[model samples]
Target: MTAKQELKKSIIASVWFMFLTFPIMVIKVNTVTHTIDWRWHNMALVGIGSFFLSMLWRYLLKKKEEGGKKDKKAGLSFIQRLLQEKQFALPGILIITLITILFPHIFSMYQTNIMTSALIFVVLGLGLNIVIGLAGLLVLGYAAFFAVGAYSYALLNLHYGVGFWIALPIGGILAALFGILLGYPVLRLRGDYLAIVTLGFGEIIRLVLENWNEFSFGPSGIKNIPKPGFFGIEMSMQTTTIYVFYIVVLLVVFTIFVINRLKNSRIGRAWVALKDDEIASQAMGIDKAKTKLRAFALGATWAGMAGVVFAAKTTFINPASFTLWESVIILCTVVLGGMGSIAGVIAGALLLILLPEYMRDFGEFRMITFGAVLILMMIFRPGGMIEDVRKTYKFEK
Candidate 1:
């Protein structure tokens, strides 16, 4: 579309959004006086801001497209050229690594904790990436696996005095088993049917955790879960945050390494084939059942490990902690980052987690702003902030 047409469309959409959200934006509840106040100025600001921002975004997109065409005609852009050079790449990586290693020490404890949380989400996003991004599965109940992992560690520690390190692997194995169980019944399902089944499964897990008071401790949840140790040396409150930060960082790196390997392997190719066309994949000798099961298993394994870390870090977990909303947030991280891209998942997790904390001063309106940003992202860059260049599907000959 022409730039003019694009700008016009954006303006229209922004105006429509402004119209729909005006009441919510303008109206305020005064809990002190028990009265409603309408702030017309805030509504106007939102409307004007949306319109101008949309126009600016469209203009930038047009410029980028134009630049891309020119670059294709000529050669790689300067930035791309620099990236291709090993001399620049090695130093860049080293610098980034150094910064990452020192980040917890550099930042305040509160910020470090946030970074730790973001890293956990990064792990979760990477796991989901295997299922939805690589395997082309629509799993709406992914948090069920996360909860299973957390609870597994919690119960093991409570009953048998299992340490965090031992319980971590056990939790992951249990979650993988559950993933296979979920995969078995839903193997024949596809598209929306698969989504619905998975969503129901997530709810079923949560409900079980809630109602099974004797087994799970129900709504009250388990408390005082053991913290991870360094050579059995217990960490105090001040040091624990940094320790968890490093642990999560290590896990994130491991996750990225494993995912990168999987993405380039023979099984990965089969997954892409299955994702593109099941009939064609079967004709090409791909075992759909095994491939699907493996995807679910691996994905759940990462989430399960993350769950163990979460349980250890927080020292408490209840059914409320593993709600459908948690699944939605993790899914959002994947979708917002770029489904099949590891770098994108990391960036998306950081953005979603840190952005809210940065806007804490805005109080309730920060959520509104956050929602607006997501909507804009969907419209402008649905592929995510950093799209994966790799193909998610492979066509059969």
Candidate 2:
């Protein structure tokens, strides 16, 4: 499109946004004085911002379209080629490793804590990556399994004095069992139907936790939970914060390793097959029941582990923390990051979590900007920030 045409479209968008935002941003009411105030500046700001943003959006959309055409002609993208070749991959890996080791030392305790939370989501995103990205299963109740893990640790420690070490694996196992429980009856379902069932299942978990006073502490939540111990040594809050960062770092590495291995394994291929064509996979002698169960179980294991870490990190547990919104955020990470791509999910988690955090300084506009960013991303890049590069094999006859 010509610049003149683009300019007209942007102006139209700006007018529309100004009109839409006028009722909320431009109008303010005072209860005590029973008076009304008009904020014209807010309206002007919205108009200007929308005008510039629309232009940027169109420019990005055009660039993406052009780049897609070029990439198709070039076969493998540069990043994909680097991934396939080991020599180029090592230096990148080493640099990232060095950064990971120095992150806590370079940042503040608050920053480290925030990063730990993001890493927890990185693990969560990976877990969901298996279900949604790999097996093409829509799991709306993922945070339900997350709740299972957090509660597993909380109740175990509160009742029997079980430590973090013992509770970690237990959390994973329990979450896996929950995953199986969810996957069993839904084995035959697909698409929207599967999503609805999972959504209902998630609500069930949340409602049960909310009402089950005798079991889950009835939404009052459990608190004063202990952090992980290191060789029976007691550490200060700062030290413990750093320790938790490293622990989550290790978990992220472990999650990536295991997930990468799973992506290349036989079952991994089975999952891809199931995702591509469930009926065809069933016809190809693949057991639909078993494969779906395995996907749910294995994918949920990571959520459970992350939940355990979450409980330890926050030293608290509540049904509110594992609500549907939390699950949505987790799902967004996988979807926004590029499903089936580890690096993408990690980047998504960091961007979604950390960016909003840093944006807190924007006050009320923080969420506004965040939501706008998401909308732009969905419009411009539906496949995610980094799409999963499919593996190709050559056959000789």
Candidate 3:
């Protein structure tokens, strides 16, 4: 590349990184407890600054391209070549780890709490991506499995006094069973019918929690849930043990690794085929029932793990938290962030969840503004802000 082109690329990349990192830093510091007095004003400036910087960068890049001044593609240096590969995600992961470790006290407890929540939702979004994106299943009651896992942890720990560690996998097993059970009955259903059935399933789970006071404790829900301990090491404010972050980080990594593996396996190919055309998949010797069930079970298991983290972090479980709206919002994350892309799903969840948290000062208008944005997203970028690596956006005019 020419020196000018190289300089422009470096500036644009640095500015884009700034756009991403600054908001996270500002949002982390602007919580309910550490509430900055001029929080909204600062946030507005951040939004405007980020907007102009990004626009200017884009404009410069486009103008250069339009000028027909072709810059030679530079051969990558050794380090640059390594980073240019798909394994760049590893270096990014290491950088995030270093940030969390080096500046542990950069955030307050509340900020840590919200970051933990974002991590959990990231897992949830990844799990849902398996079924809805790869397998093309329309599961409206994804939170039913989430409920199953949370309630399983709550009830197992509350009544039986089981430790958080043991109850997590148990919660997962129960959710898998529920998924298989649900999948068996709905394997023949498609589209709107399948959605309706899953919707009913979510409601059924919620209503069961409501009416079954004998065990579930009804609307009162369950409390005093135990926090997770790492290898017998207890996490507390004084201990300086970043167990929550570590546990969540490990689970997120594991989920991504496993999902990526599965997405490339034989079963994964079968799922894609089934999604594309059930009849053709069946013609190719893929068993529809088994493939569908596998997708459901895998997705449910991941969500169950997320539920374990959710329960531990909150230290309380309630039916109110796993409502229909929660399921819809999760779906929105998958939809708005490019379905089938794990990284995109995480980006989508972080954006959707954190945006509202930061905009709490807007009162009722916060939701109004959010709704308008969603409508615009659907109209203008229905495939999401980022297109899948395998897909391209084609505009019909």
lDDT for model 2:
0.92
- Candidate 1 runs further than 4 Å off: 1-88, 391-397
Each candidate's TM vs. the true structure? Answer: 0.84, 0.89, 0.75
lDDT of 1 by residue, 1-397 (tens): 8878877787787788788887789889999999999998887788788888878877788776676567442534344345446688789989988987999889899989888888898999999999988898999999999999999999999999998889889988999999999999999999899999999999999999999999999999999997888897867887988898888888998999999899879988887788899999999999999999999999999999999999998899999989999898888889898878787888888899889888999999998998888887886677787766553456899
lDDT (Cα atoms) of all candidates against the true structure: 0.88, 0.92, 0.79
Task: Report lDDT (Cα) of residue 200, candidate 3.
Answer: 96
Q: Please provide, for model 3 over 1-397, each residue's C-alpha lDDT reduced to its tens digit, 9 standing for 90 to 100.
A: 4757666665566556656766554455546688644334555565556656655656665664554455323322233344346678688878977876653367766666677787788888889988998899999999889999998888888888888789888888888899998999999998889999999999999989988999899988888887886577655663422567667778888898998788777888888889899999899999999999999999999888788778877888888988899888888888887778766787788888888888899989988988887886776556665544432247999
Give the lDDT ranking, best first: 2, 1, 3
> In terms of TM-score, how similar is model 1 to the real structure?
0.84
| Candidate 3 runs further than 4 Å off | 1-90, 102-104, 231-235, 238-241, 391-397
Judge candidate 2 at residue 378 and give its lDDT. 87
Rank by TM-score (best first):
2, 1, 3
State residue 327's C-alpha deviation in candidate 2, in Å. 0.4
lDDT of 2 by residue, 143-245 (tens): 9999999999999999999999999999999999999999999998998899899999989999999999999888899999999999999899999999999
